[model samples]
Target: MSRSATFDRQMLETAFSEIDAVHRSLPEATLSTLAAEVVTRVANNLRFAVQPDMVPCLDEIDMLCNALLSDDPHAATAFIENVQTKGSSYETLCLLYLTVAARRLGEWWDNDDVSFYRVTVAAGRIYAILRILRMERPIGVPDMQRAAAFASVPGENHTLGITIASDLARERGWDIDLFVGLTHDALVETLEQRQPALIGLSASGRRSMPALTRLIVALRISNPNARILVCGQIAAANLALVGLTGADAAAHDFQGAIGHMERLLDLPTGRLI
Candidate 1:
């Protein structure tokens, strides 16, 4: 089937259901065979969505699979190089797959001490599945006592990092209030009214540093007890510099941000509820 023709939501759900059914059956040999089949099916589907012109670049896909599934450092580097040569779509798909595969790997590792190779293989198969599936943003439950909020400084264009961090906090039982593209004054007013325990700021560009600093200072003056966390590409690249800004903590990623928040609030490491 043509990629577009095959990508109907119902069809995708059915395919996923079949994959899940096979997984539930759980005979070792059958599971392995099903995993390989899932990869083949998704790869075939991707050949259409990605265009026949890109079919010859299956080597790049294989390299990405090997990197995530086999822990082959060389393959990982080659995959990244290939994506740079190919286009951003390749890299986007790679990231989507990596996210899914990482989740699966976590589950498998939690269940048993599988060899790293086995973990990689499972990750590769899950990555293939993720490439062909649509992911939905999970709805967050509200928590009144430990609410969290997101804001971006003026001129800051990226919000994905902040969105993910808020989602993580929400998943851990924090009442999350996400405010993308808010100006400094608006963010402070919202924080003052909500009285949330934490305010998260994200900035992806260097030009945003001054505005972010101003916001942090404003927040501190308005709410001395509220903790502030800063994160994003810019923050990660200049951790030491941001640390000097009087923010309570700087997180490199969503996981790190959650961990830092847990420590600050005296919550258990992985359990905020």
Candidate 2:
């Protein structure tokens, strides 16, 4: 059954208002980042506050994602029809469908069963699906007082960790600014301008450590009190190395990062809810 429209309507309106404010103030270069943060915030509010019924079971998600791996358009069509027939909540279903399902697709690439081209195509499909759902459903909005900047180290091309961390941070009501493939100087300048409460840097390779160290040093100069977190394959796989990067903590995954942030900020658990 559809949720009562009243709460979702209010939440979405509030979210859009905040997004409008962000658009009015930030540089045009940052608009895309702001847009992504707004989307994450709205989806998160829908997931936690709205509590839509008819959430897809894990098995159902696995099946749908597997279907998406195939070339047949009929599979996607059937999956959509199934979701519609079950009267699943669009916001909840699409949020999980996009994030968890995309993760599954990534694993397939890891296993060498899917090509990057195929993964990119599947991701686009999910994005398109969510775009359409965004038009039709009411999204929830939560208060965002704190901010975080997430980025890969200069020259690092890895984005999965950044995407996962961004979603997790936004879910916890932190405004997220994503920096992609930026030079260290450019990133530091952006950080200085945003002055977020936290800065998260991800690197898939160890070679970027030198530049990452410089970035961290620059961050310390610009925002002395902001917590720094190092994540992604290198940091998560090598816990001891995080200290060398000057990060307060290292996280292998989303929940770990959230826990680290909570401890650093001295906020109680479940603060976002």
Name the regions of candidate 2 deviating beyond 4 angstroms: 1-146
What is candidate 2's lDDT per residue for 1-273, written digit by digit as tens? 354212233333333343234335544434333223222322332334434444556787778776665565456546765666655555445555555565566567668787654554454344434433444454332123456678888888778778877877787787788998787667877887777777788877567655665566456445545778887777655635543434678876777777877666666677476
lDDT of each: 0.53, 0.58
Residue 125 lDDT in model 2? Answer: 44
Global CA lDDT computed for model 2? 0.58
Highest lDDT: which candidate?
A: 2
C-alpha TM-scores of all predictions: 0.44, 0.45
Local error of candidate 2 at residue 141 (angstroms):
24
Please state the error at residue 90 of candidate 2 in Å: 53
Candidate RMSDs in order: 19.6, 16.6
CA error at residue 167 for candidate 2, angstroms: 2.0
